[model samples]
Structure formats: C-alpha cells, structure tokens
Target chain A: MTTTAQTRAHDAANLGLLPIFMAAAAGLTLLYFTGFAQASVYHDSAHDTRHTLAFPCH
Target chain B: MTTRIFASALFAGLLAGLVAVLLQWSLMEKLILEGEEYETGAKSHFAGVLKLNEDGETAEQAAESGDGGEEEGTTRRFALAFFATFVTWVGWALLMVAGFALTERYGVRITMKDALVWGTAGFGAIHVMTGIGLPPELPGQPAAEIELRQMWWITTAATAVIGFALMGYGRKPFHFAAGIALLIAPHLIGAPRLDDYSGMAPPELSGEYVARSYAVAFISWIVLGLAAGYFWNRLQQPPA
Candidate 1:
C-alpha cells in the first residue's frame, strides 16, 4: 500500500519546536491545576464529584 | 515601530475550540450518556452526585454526574485537548510556512485572502471534524457508554469531501470558507442528541457548541500562523 501523509509519522518532526514548548508548558500548568479522586456531598445531591477513569472514560 | 497582528485570527481559533466543546455538551452528551447511563435493566439512566469516599452508584439518577466514570472521561479529555493543542499547533504551523513559501515561490505571494483559506482548512477544518465525533459532555462521560454505533465513519466522508475540496482548490479564501462551512454545517444540521440526563441537555446543543469552538480555534491559529510565517520569511531574507 502506498504511504500517505495522513498516516505517516516522523519522530523528529513529531516533536517539533512549538509542540515541545507547548507540551512542557501544559504539563507544568496541569501539575498546578490540581485534581483529586473525590469530594463529599451533604444531602445525596448530584453536585458531588466522583471517581472515574481519566480521559479513558471519554 | 512594533508590528501589529490581527486580532481576528486569535479570536476565531479560540472561538472555534469553545464552540466545538459546547456543541458536544448540549447535544451528543446526553444521548451518549443515555445509552451509557443504563447499567441494568432495572435502573440508572445516569449517575449523578457521588457521595465519594463512602461509595455510591448511578446511571439511574445523575443530576449532572458531578463525578462517576466521567472522571475518567474528563481526564482523558484534558489530556487529549492538551495534546491536540500541542501537536496540531506545531504541526500545522510548520506545514503552513512550507505551504506559503512554496506558493510564493511558485504560485502567488501570501495574501490576506489566501491566509483565510488555508488557515480555515488546516486549523479549523481538521479540528471541527474531530470535535463532531467526540462524546458530548463538559468533563465527564463514558467511552464505552458513548458508543459511536457504527456511525464512526460518518464524519470521515464529510472530512474527505471537505478536506479534499479545500485542499485541492488550494487558494487562500476558498479554503477558509470551506473550512468554516465544514465547521458550521453540522450545527446547522442539528447536533447529535445527548440523552443521558433525560431532558437536562437539549438535542442539537452539541453541534452548535462545536461550531463556536471551531470559529475560535480558526481565528487564533490564523493570527499565529500569519505572524510566524511573515517573521520567518523576513529573517531568512538576504540584504537587498
């Protein structure tokens, strides 16, 4: 099968300069955002947060 | 004097991204959740409000699934968005410079009209399409729950038709308009239903939101691309 640009991958190009910077920034920023497994609710109300798989769920 | 950049590009790209997310939330999230919310024949159309730490259950009564399998979903989404942002931005920017330079050398010099076209196609079109297929919701939802139901490729055809046309035509403005059309068209067609919360999220909501997101992203990238392209070209130029 002929290789197409859409599916082709280039290791060097894959981590281009802008992406490298953006990812580093985003990762560091995410570390600061703070996420946890759970929080409590007073009355069985639906607003309470729950545990679910990360990104894997959606 | 300092060079000024167009605000339109930045605004458009961010708008596009926002619209894409909103569309998923309003329309597809629920329908997607509805099918997923059902854990058993007897109960749970949705899971809402986890007591957490103490253990709770749902898909039978989600006020908004403040947390559930959706936690997993949200995390994944965050990662995807982060990665998409990082990758697409660099990949497209590089491609854009190459494309523009090629055209200038062979076809025509980069112009505002051309800017709109290519930007829409690259930054706008690709993303909006991916957004359309996403399971709708703000941060939480289920992957298995939001099954594509054999409709996965529905967007593929749309992408090819639109992608190629814009790509093949290759002028700047036409590419831009086509890019906008691809983003806007599905919303106009009405968003996919998010039947999860029963009546909480309205149908067509997902598509509309996605449309706005596309608008924002397109605008933002165009500004970035244009500035970067022009600067790079000048830096590479020899004394004249």
Candidate 2:
C-alpha cells in the first residue's frame, strides 16, 4: 500500500500537458507582439529593441 | 501544480528580463541611437558630400522636410525599449519553463544543471540558427520586405526549436536523423534577402552592432538559464 501511495505521489509531481500548453501559448503571443508584430505603432515603440534583438524590422 | 509552475516562471522571467534590460542599456543602446542618426538623415555617411534623391533634392533637404517623422521623447523611447526587452525575456522564460515541465513528464530529469543546457539550447534555436541567414541589421541597413523576413524568422526559430527538442528527447535513430534534417531545412530554404547590401550606416557600425547584439543575447540567455533553473528547483520543493 505504501509503495503504491509513493508511486502515485511521484507521478503527481510531474507536470501535465495542459499547463505546459498554456504557458507556450502565452509565451508565443508575447514574443509575437514584441518581436514580430508589424503595426507601425509596435514597430515605432520597439524600434531599437527590434534592432538589438535581431528581429526583422525596417 | 499549475499555479506553482506559472509562479516560478513569472519570478524567473521577471528577473531575467531585468538583467537583459540593464545589459541592453549599457552595451547596445548607444549604437542603436547612433545608427538612427544615419537612418533619419540627421547625419550622412558621406560627410560633406550631398547625395541627390530621386526627386533631385539633397538628402539633407529631404530630411529637413520631415520624412522620417518626429523622434519620440527620450523618456518615452526609453520606456518602450525597456518594456520590449522585459516582455521578450519573460516570453522566453515562460517557454523555457514549459519546456522543462514537458520534458520532465517524458521521463527526463530536469535539474538546475540541466536548465542551463536548456537555456543554451533556447539561445541556439532563437539566435544562432536564425542569425546564420538574417545576421543582425542596423537602422538604415537595406533589407528585404519585413513581412517576408518575419515569416522566415518565425519558421527558422520554430524548426530549430522542434529540431533541438527531438534531438534532445527522441529515443530512436530515426528521430535524430529527422532532427538534423529539420535543423538544415530552413537554412536550405534560405532567408529573404535583397540584391544590394547598401545601408546609410557605415559597414563598421553595422558590424559592431551585430557582434554586440550576439554578445548581449548570449549573456542574457545564460543569466536567464541560471535564474530559471534556480527558481524551478526552488519552487518544486514542498513546503517544510
């Protein structure tokens, strides 16, 4: 019983797919806005950063 | 568990973002600002010599007509720069943490030491691989269309990430072979480019910008890896 309980605890400690997917989605959105967004406002605001980070920019 | 993962990512991401902003301020900001002078025609690469535009006006005259638009206030510009850098690093951190968690689920052990390796891999995928085609550009550097370049950049980074992940996690020889192919495929497709390599900024300035950008990115990624690894380990521990 103790071995089974411990095994269950260990498995629970590992992360699930949902949270990982959510994090990835959020990250991609933020990266897209900061690095790749083409709006002139975004381009103007992030001009120097776009250059420094090597993002494609005018 | 989900909350804990996000909390850890937030803390680590913010910390790394702060480091990246400070590094950018010190190392790269001046060069960018200087390059902008050329970009805006506030300064000319040819010094005293005047270049006539297609309209037959001198470059200086065209600049005086306000073609480049008004410069943003210094404070506002600085704020924007800081915000962009912070957002970028946070995004990268979240991705890294997610990667760590996913890999752990797949029977890979994620120690603080391993996180550093992960961080380096992130840098390799995002910067080094993409850089081979695009390199880095200065303000006035001639380039292909933004949309085309952006698409290529996204594709390259994506392929590199998947390629690296497969190589790192895959069990079969076929997986590794596929990973290598993915890594090479983007470069084989090539990045969008222009026929001419012309730019208003001096070649020396552009060269310096590329070199410094890579150096700053490397340091930031290393710091990000260390901080994320430390936090990931710390947060995973059960309360005493």
Candidate 3:
C-alpha cells in the first residue's frame, strides 16, 4: 500500500500538463525578451556589432 | 547536477543565441531584405550563391561579376560568434527560470503563471532588440535601412504586446498557438526590402519567398524556445 504522504508528494510533483507545458513554454517566452536584449547591443543602423538577439515580432 | 543544469542553460543559451543569430543573419535577412533585392548586399548569403552560375568567368571574376555571392571565408568567425551567442541565450534563460521560480516560491503566482511572464520577456524584449542591433556592425555597411527600421519596430511592438497579452488572457490551449502566433505575426508582415536580390522571376513570386522565409523563422523560434525549456527542466532539479 502507498503511503498517503507519498501519494500527495507524487501528485504535487506532477503539477499536470499545464504546468509542465508552461515550464517549457516559459523558456521560449524568456528567449523573446533576452533576444531583444541583444538590441541593446545594436543601436539602429548607426552602430555595428549587434549581439544577435531578435524579437521576431518586431 | 546543479552546476550541470546551469551549464546546460549556458549551453542552451549559447546555442539558442547562435541559432537566433544565424537565423537573423542568414534566414531573416534573406526573406525580409534579400527577397526584395537580388544582391545579398554588403553582407553575405550562403544560399543565394546557389542561384548564381559562373560558366564562362573565373571563380573570383564570376563572383565579382555579381554571379557568385557566398559568405565563404567568414564562416569560421560567424560560427564562433554563433557559438558564443548560443551560450549567452542559455544563460539568459537559466537566469529567468531560476528567478521566476524563486519568485513563485513566495506565492507571487503559480509556477505556470510565472512562466507566462518569462515568455513575455523572451519574446517581447529579446528578439526584436537583437534583430535591430547586430547587422549594422558587419563589414561593408549597406545603406542604413532607415524606413524599414521604423516600419518593423512599430508593427512588431504592437503585435508583441497585443498578441502576448491576449495569449496570457486566454491561457492553456491558447498558450502554444499564441506563442506561435506571437512569434510569426511580425515577420509575416514582410520586413521592408530595399534592393532585394532574391530575384523572383515574375516578381509575384515574392509571396512565395515571404511565406517560405516566415515558415522557417517560425520553426527556428519554436526550436529556440523548446531547447531553452528542456535545458531549464534539467537544471531545475539541481540541488541548491
């Protein structure tokens, strides 16, 4: 027989597909902003040497 | 293990950054700018050279004759730069995952909810900035693509803010689709191409070029995000 505490721990660990997918999704989401952070390295057409970050939307 | 996770994030970032860089440099430039112009302009395109043929002229002569344009020599440098950028991308992602998770520990939001903010920061802030920044620095500056810049930023920002907000509002089933939409909506709008050399024989083929390029861009973005996510998950179990 499974211990009640063990079962609860297992349930908490799972967090369902939404959380798992979100965790995965979040990685991608953060990439967008950090990718834009690359822009700070590039200032329009005036300067050169961009850091390779991009916001595909922009 | 914690260190390994951190390292993985770094690796992921560098790979992500490098891939993002390459996509921006090779693929993005081609679809948006090169599609309109036949020439690769001041920079280079590895693929565009395929369209060029040099039957009669010397290799150098043909290349100069505007028939052979390839980024042959700079491959090593670009490769190195790509590797470094990829590392940085992972670093950024790791920082985000860890930071957001910590905040959630305080009950700021559920872990899933926090992930949403992380996604916004990634999509909204990072990619656009990088795209706008890097190209000007490469050797042989093309004419400052000013009009294109304005057009890109305005529409891109609008789509990002509105798109992500809606995605966030809707959540769940909306997440993946929203993420994909937010990713592509800007690029699909067609970045301004001056002197584009992709050379659609009939000119109308431009749509095909745009669609093909945007499709590639979406795929790359998705890959970038997935890599970061997998790395983040591996790192999560590291003992603090």
Candidate 4:
C-alpha cells in the first residue's frame, strides 16, 4: 500500500477514540442536566426529555 | 473518504432523529402529559381526598371540563424535543460509525446485515441491558439517589458494550469466557433501587411507561442502525 493509503487506514482504524470520548462527555453532561441536576435550575429544561425517555421524576 | 463518512453519519443522525420524534409523539407524549398532571397535582391515580378538588370532580372529569388541557405552549415543547432528538441521534450515529470502522479494522466482515446485528447489540448495551436493572420510571415515582443510580447505569452500559465487543471480535476460548463474564458482571452487582416503591404515580402507569420506553428504544435503535449502515455502505462505493 502507498504511504498515504497506509496512513489513512491507520487513522481510520484508530479513528474512534476522540469521538467516543467526546460523546461520552456529552452524554454524561446531558444525563446530569436531564436526570440529576438540582430541581429548580435543571428540572424544567429536561422535563420533556425525561418524560420522553420515561425517566423517573417526581 | 472522511467527508463521505461524516456526511453519511450526519444524514443518518437526522433520519433517526425524525423517527424518534415521531415515535415519541405518537407513543409516549400523552402518557407523559398525563403523568405530568399527576405530578403537578392536577390528577390522582387513586381516588381520595388527595385528589384535586375542581368542584369536587375527578381528574378525568376536570380534564374533560377543559380546566386541565390549557398547556402554556406546545410549539416550544415540540421544537425542543426535535432539537434534543436530533442532537442525541447524531452523537449516537457518530459512535455507531466509529464502532463499525473499528470492527472493520479487526477483519470483521462489514455488511448491511451485520450492521443490523450491531444495531441490536447497541440497543442491548445502551438501553436493554442497563434497563434490566433500572426499568424506566414514571413521573412522581420514588428512586434511589441519583449518584448511585447514575453510577450503576454507566457501569452497566460500559460492561455490556465491552462484553458485546469481545463476543464479536474475540477469537479464543478464554476471550469468549471473559466476554461472558463481562456481560454478567453488571447484573451481579445489581442496580441501585429504592427501599420502598412508594410514589404518586399508579403502579399500572409505571408499568405501561416501562414497557413503552423499551418498545420505543428497540424500534429507534434498529432503524438508526440500519439507516447508518445503509448510508455508510452507499458512501463507501467507488465513483463510477
């Protein structure tokens, strides 16, 4: 394989680390704001989402 | 190649988002509004003094009277829902594409059929397996502390994903056994739960909520996976 092709393949093979970790961080932030944040500041914003997901909220 | 992958991923994400918005609207929105009524003291599951006294009428009667149907704004709610759905599926699509790329690197055959299986596995890891411990909860339901519940939820998802990865890519007997171990580990640890199930929402409502949530997750993940796979395959084709 040409150097460029090998490099591209190598990058693609390991391509997920950044995206995966970023997704995890974003997921955690959304989960926190939607699921666990203090009621007054966070509850209303996530109300629709929480219900849509059927998460427990009182 | 990079541009193709991103383009496919973006389109798949948007498609999944639209599907999710439609599914949630048709299936879960009413249940949610009803649950909200109960949560906000506009209704009660069991008839009693605790029930809101709109001229001593029941919740259903009060609702029929039009005293309860006056929501502040629905347009805002739907717009937010669409945005959230779009963002979430996009993130999921990116992850899905990355996962496929990783598997391809390890010599696993990538095909549309195989992508469907991957989609199922993704559902299992993110929603089904984790939900085994923490079934969807309704409004006004009591729950374990958020920290503990969140911890268990993340752990379960992580364990399930690793287990699935091993099962798909592992070559040796030891790898297989280890994969099985990973799958079972989270459940053995158990999800955090409330000591008592006391809550304002009725048991029946909670039951329905859990079932519907699982149903939606199953459908959404399947479609999302298939669509992503289809796009990826199409994009990978060489120009004529």
Candidate 5:
C-alpha cells in the first residue's frame, strides 16, 4: 500500500512538459494573430481591440 | 491531466473574454470611435475652432455627415473585434495555465489565491510595466515606427514576466535582486519614441482614453484571474 501511494504521488507530480510546451505554442500563435500580425486585414479587423488592449497598432 | 488543464483554461478564458468584451463595448468603444473620427479626418480639431471650410464648416458639422454602407462594415468590425478579443483571452489563459502546470511540476501547487497572484503578475507585466514606457494610445495619437515599438513592447513584457517569475520562485537574495534588475532593464534601455509629440485628437480626450482603458483592463484582469483560479481548482478535483 505504501509503494502504491508513492507511485501514485510520483505519477501525479510527473505531469510532463509536453502540455506546457504545446499550450505555449498555441497561445503565442493566437496572440500573434490578435496583437502582432502585420497583415492589413488583421490590423483593420482588430483595430479597436488592439487599441483598447494597448497592443501596438497603426 | 493535460486535457484537464486545457479544459480549465478554455472555460476560464471564455468566461473572462465574455466579460471583457462586454466591458469594452460599454465603456471603451465610444472613445475609440471618437478618436477614429480625428484619425480619418472626419472631424478635425483645428477645423472645429477655425472653421476651415469655405462654407465655414465646423468639425461638428463635418462629423454630422453620415457615411453610407456603414451598416455592413460595422457588423463586420464588431464580429472581428469579438473574435479577436476572445482569442486573445484564450491565448492568455493557455499561457497562464501552462505556467501553473510548470510551477506544479516544481512542487508549487496553485490554489485559487495563488492564481489571483499570477493574474496580477500578468497584468503588471503585460499592461502596467509595458505602459510605463508606452501608455495606452488613442487612434490618432502620434507614435514611433510600429515595428520598433512592437519590438520594445515585446521585450519589456518578456523581461517583466521572467523577472516576476524569479521573484516568485527564487529563494536566494541574489535571485530577487536579479529579478528587480531584469524588471528595470528594459525601461533603462528605453522604449522607442517619436521626435515630436503631435496628435490629431485633443490631449484631454487622449488622457481620458488612456485612463479608461487602464480602468477597463484592470477590472478585466481581476475577473480573468478569479475565473481562471476557480476553473483550475474545479477541474483538478478528483472524480467523486
């Protein structure tokens, strides 16, 4: 029972790094589109929001 | 666990984003639209006072002129704003949740209170720290080149984030001092700036816009923190 508890604790702590990396990648991509994309369409579309959120905008 | 984290992030982000967009529409959109009038020359600051038109047309008179086919454009813009804001919040949520997970791996469990602290750190890094060099701007506000400003803004935010992380996690005095230094380094380097400060919009209007934007951002970020924390706790509970 002690061994099982230890193993469960180990597994719980070992939540792995992959999810963190994947989430970071996805998050950065979305942020780029909303806040930093240079395309005129993106700019025009997100103009007010970009300004409202204090993102750099034309 | 991964799926749970993502699910928590998505739900929290959606809730926060909804609140943020509603707040934006009610509190901030009008200032932006008014600023755009100056930006597009639909209303001119000088024209209003000087009566620049041959027919003595004031800026208010010019503004009174309506644009055609704006209904379609307004609808499109509104849709875009909604989507962008939602995406932005989700992105923030994902990043924050990932941070939470990473910290947990190092033996730091994030409670709802801890999540609120993280959210404040986020606001400090992304909004307050960056805004020190680059305050919120109106549509017609003068600025440096976009690329340069963006580079500085990103650098400041990254440094601030790292700095905050160190301060939060580091046990040593050196580490804390290093974090403080990192926090100050970007400001010391300075943000890119225009040679002259001239804007189409009046200064009072611009001031109000900046103030209101910060107010809105603060409230939204607090809500985001609470929502993220609540969801994070809710999802992490063991199945009954």
Candidate 6:
C-alpha cells in the first residue's frame, strides 16, 4: 500500500502534459503575431519590435 | 509551485522589459523613425528627382508638409513600445521559468550558471536561427509573402530549439548526431526569398538597423537568462 502511494505521488510530481501544452499554445500565439500575423493588423508595432529585438524580419 | 514560478518569471520579465525599453529608446528609435520618414516619402534616397507637389509648392516645402500626419507621434510610439516590450519580456520569462522547472523535474541539475547557458540557447533558437533567414527589416522594405516567411521562421526556430535540446540532454552518440542534423535541417531548406530586393529606405539605414538590433538582442537575452535563473532559484527554496 505504501509503495503504491509513493508511486502515485511520484507520478503527480512529474512534469506532465498540461503545462507543456499550455506553454506551446502561448508560444504559438505570440509567434503568430511576431512572425505571421497580417501586416495590416499590427505591422507598425511588430515592425518596431522586430527592429528593437533584431528579429530578422526583412 | 506554479504560482511561485510565475511570480519569479513576472519579476524577471519586468526587469528585462525595462532594460529593453530603455535600450530601444536610446538606441533603435531614431533609426526606425528615419526609415519611416523614407517609407512615407518624406525623404528620398535617390537624388535629382524633384518631389512633385500637387499644390505646386517647392519640393522642400512639400517635404515639410508631408511630415504632419495621423501617424506622426513620438509619444504614442514610445508608449506602445514600452507596453509591448514589457509584455513580451514577461512572456519570455514565463517560458524560461517553466523550462527550469521542467528540467528540474526531469532530473537534470539546474544552476544559475546553467540558466545563463539556457538564455544563450534561447537567444540562438529565437533570434539567431530565425534571423539567419530573415534579418531585421525596416519600413518601406519589400518582402516575400508573409505566409511563406512565417512558415520558414517557425520551422527554423522549432528545429533549432529541438536541436539544442537534444544536444544538451541526450546522452547517446546517436542523439548527438540527431541533434546536429536538426541544427542543420532548417538551413538545408533555405528560407523563402523575394524575386527582387527593393525598399524605399537607403541600404545604409537597413544595415545600421540590423547591426544595432542584433547587438541589443544579444545583451538582453543574456540578462534575461541570468535574471530568470536567479529569481527562480531564490523563489523555489524553502525559507531559512
């Protein structure tokens, strides 16, 4: 019984799928705006950011 | 645990954002404004061709008039820039902190020094890898289709990140080879390009913009990694 409980605790402590998936989603959302969003939407803002951070957008 | 990580990330993010905004205000803002001036036709690279005024005014007088517009406001631009920088840094900090927790959970030893390395790798994957294909562009610059550029940028950054991960964490020789392959994969499939290179801004302006942009990015990422690591380490420890 103790062994089983310990195993369950270990699994719970492991970094699981949810955080990883959420991070990916957040990353992709940012990426869309930074790299792929329509220029008409936020072109100036993105353009300024691209230059400030030096992301090669040209 | 999540709250602690986020708190650490938010703190680091705010600090990094401040650094980015200050640097941008001091270093890059002028270059961008000049590029815009050319893009909007307020200035011209090619000489000898007079800017014809619909009002039949002198070229110099017309140029002066062109400067006034809905788009012309330093205050607005700076405000927007500050907000964007802050949010962006916060996002990055969250990712960095999460990465630290993930690594720790996976049994890898993490340290402040290691975080610095992580920061460099982040810089490489996010900026250097993608930038290899698409260096910073300025206003009035011609570009290929946005869809294609986006596809390539995502592919490059993804592959680069995977490559770095494998190389850093994989223990086997095959893993190393696989990591190397991933690193080269994006470059092998070159980035999309325009059939022609053209932009209203002068070449010198673009060059300066690219150089300065890289310089600032390199410095900022280093700081971000260090700060994130320091904060995460401090926050995660039990009180004495």
TM-score of chain B of each: 0.42, 0.89, 0.42, 0.88, 0.90, 0.90
**How much lDDT does each candidate structure score?**
0.39, 0.84, 0.45, 0.72, 0.85, 0.75
DockQ, in order, for the candidates? 0.05, 0.73, 0.08, 0.30, 0.73, 0.42
lDDT of each residue in A1-58, candidate 3, tens digit only:
5698898777555333344345435554544433333363323321111222322222
lDDT (tens digit, per residue) of candidate 5 on B125-198? 99999999999999878899999999999999999999999999999999899999999999999999988877
- Point out the worst 10-residue segment of candidate 6 chain B by lDDT: B50-59
Best by lDDT: 5
Residue B15, candidate 6: Cα error in Å is 1.6
As for lDDT, the candidate ahead, 4 or 5, is: 5
What candidate 4 gets wrong by more than 4 Å, as runs, is A1-43, A54-58, B52-72, B237-240
DockQ ranking, high to low:
5, 2, 6, 4, 3, 1
Sort by TM-score, top down from the best: 5, 2, 6, 4, 3, 1
Q: In model 5, what is the error at residue B109, expressed in angstroms?
A: 0.8
Q: How much of the true contact map at the interface does candidate 6 reproduce, as a fraction? A: 0.30
- Tell how far residue B221 is off in model 6, in angstroms: 0.5
In model 6, residue pairs whose N, Cα or C atoms come closer than 3 Å (at least 3 residues apart or on different chains), thus clashing, are: A56-B134, A56-B135, A56-B136
In order, what are the TM-scores of chain A for the candidates? Answer: 0.32, 0.73, 0.35, 0.53, 0.74, 0.58
DockQ of 5: 0.73
**What DockQ does candidate 2 have relative to the true complex?**
0.73
DockQ: which candidate is best?
5
Q: Please give, as one word, the docking class of candidate 2.
A: medium
Give candidate 4's TM-score.
0.81
List model 6 lDDT by residue over B147-189, tens digit each. 7877888788778878988898889988988988988888888
Candidate 4 lDDT over B100-174, as tens digits, reads 655665657468888788789988998888788887776666788866877787788878889988887788888
